[model samples]
Target: MQKVTLYTKLNCHLCQDVYMMLMELTLETPLEIDLVDITHAHNSHIRAKYTDRIPVLARPQSEVELEWPFTMADIRAFLSDPAPDS
Candidate 1:
């Protein structure tokens, strides 16, 4: 299983779109999705980092972070690979 985390905020259309995409991807892939709402995060650091970068996709323990404007193809490729590309 692959662990996935999405940084997001409330009422963001882009973030909502990404959330829906992630849900759809689940039918074809094994992804454990965790959503982080920067709007109400307890951690100030996390809120600060993703304030303007909502809809970012991150895999735990991997340095690679996917920002907005990513396609379903990009998500598919990322889920299929275990390691972050160098």
Candidate 2:
């Protein structure tokens, strides 16, 4: 299974869309999804890191992130390609 982290905030349509896409991907792939709410974090660190770019999908170990406005193809590519150092 791959570790997929989603950095997002409340009332974000793009975040919701990414969540939906992650759910769909779960049905076809083995992904351990971790949803992080930027608002809940202290000092707005997460918010600052991903303020303009909510719904950021990151592979922690690999430090790979897939930003918003991505299609299913983009996700598929991410999944198809394994982490560099899982």
- TM-scores for candidates 1 onward, in order: 0.88, 0.86
Candidate 1 local accuracy as lDDT? 0.86
Tens digits of per-residue lDDT, candidate 2, 7-56, equal 88899988989889889988987889899898887866677998888878
Question: Model 1: per-residue lDDT, tens digit, 2-86?
Answer: 7888999888999999989999998987778989998899999999998988889988878778898899999887777768632
Stretches of candidate 1 exceeding 4 Å from the true structure: 84-86
Regions of model 2 farther than 4 Å from truth: none
Give the winner by lDDT.
1
| Native-referenced Cα lDDT, model 2 | 0.84
What C-alpha lDDT, on a 0 to 100 scale, does residue 33 get in candidate 1? 91
Task: Report the number of clashing residue pairs per model.
Answer: 0, 0
